[model samples]
Target: MIIDYGATPPIEELSIGDGSHLANYRRVYASSEKAAARGEVDLDQWFRDCDAAGIGKTVIKARDVETTFGGRISNEEVAEVVARHPDRFIGFAGVDPNKGMTALRELEHAVTELGLKGLNVQCFENRLAPDDRRMYPLYAKCIELDIPVNIHVGINFSLKSSPEFGRPETLDRVLCDFPELRVCASPPGWPWVQELLAVAWRHPNLWIGLVAIRPRLMTVDHSGYGPLLQYGRTILKDRMIAGTAWPMQPMGRVIEEIRALPVDADIADLWLGGNAQRFLGM
Candidate 1:
């Protein structure tokens, strides 16, 4: 089965409240729309598009930034969709780290009560390093719940926070502390690709999701992603997961480009879907 590991469902509106955070997303949405208009995407349309692209299931993610820029897509919102289309969608919950124990309770409620599958941590949005102690509680909660975590682990372009916050090196400490935690470092940790590879090689539970990045660019000579592409097809074949980062790139186009990559059928299958299934324990 083809599973998309990370994707924002075609929600008519995302509540990214006012400020630089909201503005940054506005820019992201605007740039993304250049590839495919938002008017053409809706929940059911999203399912049809995924089907056309051979995507059997999609994990819908939501982000909460109440402590920072003031925005949220509550657990209830994501669970509603997954409840409506249980077969086609999986829900990942986002909790504001600043909420402390409250966030932990919410996460437990999300997985146990709401039936969410995993956790989504936008490290940069939280303005905390991936290894920040403030996030340790949440990590512990996820481990206790036996759900994987998808964390932003690369440079973030938003002006609201330092790009260093998303460094892949930070994850090393997190992995060291929580060796059994299933973590997917999103965006492939570009510019620090080798560092991430080493970390992933050291931690069997770590996975990489190619989100907000086109597979075609990974093969380009000077794209800075060439090494990642090489390792993904070879040594790290089972550690890679495909994600369209929809709106950033059209789902159909992303799938087509990935199919065109110079990799063996087995490697492609693992990268495209098998790895995600294994990571999520589906």
Candidate 2:
């Protein structure tokens, strides 16, 4: 049972607008030929692809960057998808921290009323550091709701934002403040892979998501992802999560690469699905 922890499906509501900052980074992360196009995606084909890749569930996120970038994937839109295919999709709600109390209300609605299971925060895109005070309320809310948060913790390709906003060290403070908050810091925290690993080591509630990255690269020496493979099979075996960051890469290739990593069969299973099942309380 493979659960893709992070995915931006090709739905109309989740489509990237031309004026959005994500347009600038699309080419960098999006490998699919159709990814460059605007408008509704072939939803049927997307499900077919997931089936072929053996993806049992995919977590789709609604992103709200309205305060800074005028972008949003409304919770209603994400809920719609989950409503149609509850067995195949898990929805994560997005709230802009700059919205202050409004953001907290939105998150409560997303989880309780809309049935979204988690929160997705893109700090860089929102122009706030992970430990920024504005984000604390949402973290607290996640704990109150007993839902996990998936945070963007590594380099962001958007030219409009600095990668410093995503520095893994900032996460350490957030984790320290909310020790009970379940976090999935994603894209494997590259360029600071070791630092993120150290943070993950310190927090049992933290899990690293191998999203928007090439899994096979971790097996190569000097790839800077070596420690993840080394420690993931040992100390961090239960703390690793797998995600395709789909449309960034093909689902089959991502799953194949993860399965091909040089770890014991059981450890590989943890990275691919077991860990997420536990994290999502499945």
Candidate 3:
């Protein structure tokens, strides 16, 4: 639905590392190569198409791909724009959790100085998972700040050597350990939507989101998750949201992709901008 669980910023707007290029990874090589070859990498065109398609707002990450958020917008850059166009965007800080205290401090910068509403953390990139006890310190800071964390779920764009970090179930431990923290699981809900719904039902704060990752409702086998889709109809109708991943895909394609889904006007309203409006608190 139109919810924020910490998704990345517009990658097209970001350079490969100055916060654009991500860490050293093999899959990243393939992904980057593919992106470069695509050549449909203009940022404004993507935003324009989304706006034309009636897509509401986008969540941009402060640091992603960048080893230290290299070229594009830093938390400062994001803060400046969000402060100016607060209605159009929501800022989330992406940090290397492996950096320990520095990661937490960067998060503080996102919240205290940049005024970000939440975080989009790459658990796989940091050599950690949501369940890692060593990372509890970061979660502690999030709880104190009242911000939600969106972990990269499903197949990672940058590709990870280890899949353990991407498991939705790993978060079960985090949910049980810290009941107060709000976390959003993005994509396929892989493993199981029932498990996700069950977990969310158990804890009011846990959530699931679709951040330019496509929707399950559009392609579900419908045998198991039929009811969820039924209940999610409200969100499906009013809260559908999309992210182009910028240079990865043409912005027009993202809008077409949503339009291609089986959802009707009600769901279209949500996925386009309604949900984001609510999630970003716009």
Instruction: Evaluate candidate 3 by giving its C-alpha RMSD to the native, one decimal.
Output: 5.0
Error of 2 at 226 (Å): 1.2
Clashing residue pairs in candidate 1 are none
Q: TM-score of each candidate? A: 0.94, 0.95, 0.72
Model 2 segments more than 4 A misplaced: 30-41
Compared with the true structure, the alpha-carbon lDDT of candidate 3 equals 0.58
User: 1-282 in candidate 3: lDDT tens per residue?
Assistant: 222222233443443343222444335445633643344534455456556645456576665433433333466666776676665577777666666787789888889877887777766565567788756887888889878777766455443335566776777788888988867666535546566556555665655565434344455675354444544564333323445554444444456666666667667556555655554545
Which one is best on TM-score? Answer: 2
Q: How many times do residue backbones clash in model 1?
A: 0
Question: What value does the lDDT take at residue 268 in candidate 3?
Answer: 56
- Candidate 1 C-alpha lDDT tens digits along 89-132: 88999998988889989999999999999999988888989999
TM-score of 3: 0.72
Give stretches of model 3 more than 4 Å off.
1-13, 18-38, 64-73, 80-87, 157-160, 191-198, 220-231, 234-242, 252-264
* Residue-level lDDT for 1 in candidate 2: 91
Q: How much is 272 displaced in model 3, in angstroms?
A: 3.8
Model 1 poorest 10 in a row by lDDT: 12-21
